[model samples]
Target: MINVFQPSLGEAEAAAVAEVFASNWTGRGPRTAAFEAEFAAHLGVPAEQLLFTNSCTSGLFLAVELLELGPGDEVVLPSVSFVAAANAVAAAGARPVFCDSDERTLNPTVAHVEAALTDRTRAVLVLHYGGRPGDIAGIAALCRERGLTLVEDAACAVASAVGETACGTFGDLASWSFDSMKTLVTGDGGALYVRDPELARRARQLAYYGLETASSLDAAGHSDRWWEPRVGGFGRRIVGNDVTAAIGSVQLRRLPDFVARRRELTELYDRLLAGVAGVRTPPTLPAGHRDSYYFYWVQLDPAIRDGVAADLLAADIYTTFRYPALHRVPIYGAGELTLPGAEAAADRTLLLPLHQGLTDAQAHTVVEALAGAVAGRAGAAPAGE
Candidate 1:
């Protein structure tokens, strides 16, 4: 069966892990630090600005804590975002204000974010939906004007950028994912970046038990009493391990080829599904917008979306929608708000299989199945009607 997300791994990753195993020191160590530095370079940021974490979820939670958000604060984020982003804010005693997104793009516009802002709003967190850097520049400008914090959930945008500047660097703080399914597969890991050097230093400490201690390898490097650790702040041990980092380093080297193949597949899908009945392909990106091509999605008639998806499933072509609208999620307490844009996305959007492993034949098979599904159901009434 075709998968919507799959990691491209092989001998290189296995060999890297083998090396890590042979080294005898596999916790957060030289390999982890090297991976962070390389990733920072990829994002065009200082090495000190990045902190490796266990997962993107951990980075999100760390972002909330580092921002010092609390009960009276409200973090404005796109409704079509990962649950962890909302959970992070809500868990931190801060209110999460869910905003709308463009129906076609599934990313919040600056207007949508501004509409959700209240006097209580302290920060704005937005995901680069499907790896499109949606209005982030304008939102950054808006955040600057309002003196509010901006945190970018760049989990989908490992290689996305407006121009030379990276997507994750636009905001005050940002986080990225490197899980098995993500563009950069590390099995399970993430990283955080803080614009301020001071805050970045503090955040690094906070991730590792908030301790100002001499590391195990270089115990005597810092001071005489290397055994004694100073507990600095309230924090958690959520650092990425050297094993995953080893795999990440190898993956990072091979990322360009992965991205190129995905782009090739994306273009093929666009052409293949161009005229399929009831199908609406993703809109062309604006000038200077470089997509990471993490997810390739299409919109269909909401009434028949589920039916078409079921048909595709039966045909062995996996299809699904990401990010059910967060506002409708009862836990956020914004279920009553009418957000047609986000609602439209939740109802009509379907993500097709667009992973690095997908071949030209696989893509053709998916499009063929999709076309057949839509055509078969086109003449019929909506599923239940």
Candidate 2:
């Protein structure tokens, strides 16, 4: 069976973990700190700006929590995004206002965000869906003009960039993922990058039990009080441990190669599927931007999408829909808000296998299966009465 997603871990990762096991210091220790530094360096950002977490969800939650939002405050986000973006806003006691995506790109534009803005709106969460960078520069300008915070959900965008600048650096705060299926697999972990020093300090304390670490203690005072622990704020055990960090450091070294392989596979898929009837490939990215290709998505006629997915499953080739429209979800409430683009995308988009481990033959097989499925569905269509 061909998997839609898989992590590329090998002897290097195993050796890293083995070393961690041998060290006997596997909690939030030197290895974790080293990973944070290396990750920031990869993005060309300062080490002080990054805070490692247990998952991207936790990083996002910390971003919202730092804003100190409450029931009266609101955060606007696209309905087509992963539910975690909405969940983070809700977790911070802020209402998540749903917005529409641009049908071509499957990401929200500045106009869609503007339309959702209310006086109570405090922030805008922008997700780089499928590792494709959205209009982040434009969105950042709008956020600045409106006095709103910008939090980037860069979970799928490890090395993705708009022009020469990276995606995560544009927003005021950003969250990155390194879960089992993400571009950088740390087994299960994430990181938060914040522009504000106070926010970074708060996030670091929050990751632990609100207690100052030994380094922080030295900075505060070196007197007799140095031996005593200080609890400065409310917190939780959300920090990523050294064991996972060790693995992540090794993965980090190989990210450029991983991204390159995925891009090559995506190009093959595009070449194979071009001009196939009733099939719409993902929009070509604008010049100066690059996608990490976390999932190579294509849109099929909504009527036959389900059948095509089933056909692929029967062929032992796995596929999936990226996400459902968040506003239509029950827990987010059955709001009257209408997002035509989001609804349209939810009904038609399908994710094909595009991971580091996928070979040229596997990609060809996937495209062939899809073409056959589309043809079968076309032939079975009812004639006009």
Candidate 3:
């Protein structure tokens, strides 16, 4: 069976993990600090601006929490994104205002976001879906003019540049993921990056049970030899352990290679499926935005989409349904959203296997199966009566 997603981890990762195990300090110590420093440097930001967390979901939630948004406030986001985007806003005690995406790109347009904004809107969460930049500059401009904070959920996109600038560097704050299936994986890890010093300080404090590490201790009037947290924030530390950080550091070093390999596979798919029947490949971004292929999605013409997924499944190729429009989900436990474009993509978007492990042969096999599925379905339709 050909799997849709497989992480590329081998002796190098094992060696790093072994080293961490050998060391006695395995909790948010030297290794974690090192990983943070390296990750920040990769983003071209100062080291102090980044904070690591257990998952991208946690980073998103923490970012919203620090913003002090609550019940009366709202955060605007596209319904086409992973549910984590919606959940994070809800976790912050704020509402998520769902918007539509341009059908071709699968990302929320600036106009769509502006339409969703209301007096209560406090922030906008933009996702770099499938490793493509989602109009970062335009969205940033809109957010600035509207007095709204921009929080980038760049979990699927890392090291992707937009007009010579990286995606993660555009927003006021951003959350990144290192899930096993992502372009850069650490089994499970995440980070938060902030451009403001005060916010960075507060985020650092929040991550570690609101304790002031040595830095905060030095500021206090310590007459005693031993130092402690100046003010009680919660002694429970949210800091990640060293074992995962060590693994993450190694993954960080190999990220460029991973991106390159995935791009190679995507270009191959583009060549094969360029004008295939009943298929629409994910659209290309403007010239300034580059892609990092975390997922390679295609749209099936409705006439044959239903059979497309089952056919791929029968052929032992794994496929996924990215997301239904958030407003349409029963998470509201209610009826439906009024978004037409998002609803259309939600029903038709199909993900093709595109991971670092995918070979030239595997890419061809999936494309062949897809072509057959679409043709078979189109051929089987009932004749006009």
- Candidates in order, TM-scores: namely 0.97, 0.96, 0.94
Q: How well does model 3 score by local distance difference test? A: 0.83
Candidate 3 wrongly placed segments (more than 4 Å)? 214-236, 333-336, 383-385
- Against the true structure, whose TM-score is highest? 1
Off by over 4 Å in 1: 214-225, 382-385
lDDT accuracy of residue 60 in candidate 2: 88
Q: Write down the worst ten-residue block by lDDT for model 1.
A: 213-222
Maximum-lDDT candidate: 1
Model 2 TM-score, 2 decimals? 0.96
Q: Per-residue CA lDDT of candidate 1, range 1-385, in tens? A: 9999999999999999999999998998999999999999999999998998999999999999998999999999998998999999999999999888999999989899999999999999999998999899999999999999999999999999998989999999999999988989888999999999999999999999998762644667666777777789988998999999999999999999989999999999888887776789999999999999998998988778999999989888888899899888899888578889999999999999998999999998888888878777776865564
Task: Looking at model 3, report the run of 10 residues with the lowest lDDT sum.
Answer: 228-237
Q: Rate the local accuracy (lDDT) of all candidates.
A: 0.91, 0.89, 0.83
Ordered by lDDT, highest first, the candidates read: 1, 2, 3
Candidate 3 residue 161 C-alpha distance from true site, Å: 2.1
